[model samples]
Target: MRVQPLIAVEDIERSRRWYQRLFDCVGVHGAGDYEQLMMPGDDTFFLQLHLWEVHGHPNLEPAFVRPGHGVLLWFEVEEFDEAVTRARDMDAWIVQEPHVNARANHLECWLHDPDGYTVVLASPFGDVE
Candidate 1:
């Protein structure tokens, strides 16, 4: 089974650009208000972004009032340090700094998207000291 995460954002364009820069992902499909983002070498979309206010719901502000209160968007990267540098350069909100995850046998860092969505960037633990 393939899992595709859909994120609701206040600004679609901003989120789209942020995701593209942060993950090195691409928007394979989308026109306005919505976009399906695919990771490198992946046929199916790994994530999707939609505007909070859809077209159908006229005069409706938003279907849900809360955004990313208890959710995490996890991702694994091959070039851990490079990815971290990119994130840092973008000035993305750092939820957690890079550290070794002994339990998971990997190194991980946490960040937040423009819309306050939690994202974890991890790489397999290697002898890099």
Candidate 2:
């Protein structure tokens, strides 16, 4: 089974570019009120971007813009370093610099997407060392 997480953004195209660059993914669903992004060649669950209040999804309204109140959109990236660099190049809001998580024994960087969602890019266990 695959898990696909969707977020409501202000601009579908803008968020699409930001995410595609950071994750090195593609916008398989193209630009619309909603979009789905997938890894390079894989086509399974990855992520989804929906325009705010477009489809009337529960809890996806302008009042709910501050999404990172408690949750995190976590992802494990194989090329952790490159991903971090890509994020920096895009001037993405970095909440925490890249660092090794002793507990997880890997690397991780915390950042926020265009819509203010707390996004995490983590390396595979033991991949850092």
Candidate 3:
């Protein structure tokens, strides 16, 4: 089974562009209350963007009105430094600058998305040795 992560945002289009730039991916199901984003030449979507207060999902809005309280969306990127560069170019809110993560033994950059989610981009596991 594969795990597909979806986050609720205030503006789908804005978040779509932000994530697309961050991962250099595309929004297959673009511009709506919900969107499916996938990597280039990939069949499955890597992430999903859903508008809050819609979709009728339980605890989606008023039930749990937190943008990204306790969750962290982490992705392993092959081009770790380039990804960090893109994030910086986008003027993204950087939670932490790029650094070697001792626990994971890889490079990582922590950032905040448009919706206040903590998005962590890391190099492939064990890349640093």
lDDT values of the candidates? 0.84, 0.87, 0.89
lDDT of candidate model 1 versus the reference:
0.84
Please provide, for model 3 over 1-129, each residue's C-alpha lDDT reduced to its tens digit, 9 standing for 90 to 100: 889988888899999999999889998985679999999899899888998889688656753545788999999999998999999999999989999998889999999898889999999888887
TM-score, predicted candidate 2 vs. hidden true structure: 0.92
lDDT of 2 by residue, 1-129 (tens): 788888878899999999988988888877689899988769584888888787678877775336657779999998899999999999999999999998888999999998788999999988755
The candidate 3 region of ten consecutive residues with least summed lDDT is 58-67
For lDDT, candidate 1 versus 3, the one ahead is: 3
Model 2 is weakest, by summed lDDT over 10 consecutive residues, at: 59-68
Ordered from best to worst TM-score, the candidate numbers read 3, 2, 1
Q: For every model shown, what is its TM-score relative to the native structure? A: 0.85, 0.92, 0.94
Which residue pairs of candidate 2 clash?
none
**CA error at residue 79 for candidate 1, angstroms:** 1.5
Please tell me which model should have the higher TM-score, number 1 or number 3.
Answer: 3
- What is residue 52's positional error in candidate 3, in angstroms? 0.7
* Model 3 deviation from the true structure expressed as Cα RMSD, one decimal place: 1.3
Name the candidate, 2 or 3, with the larger lDDT value: 3
Least lDDT summed over 10 consecutive residues: which range in candidate 1?
57-66
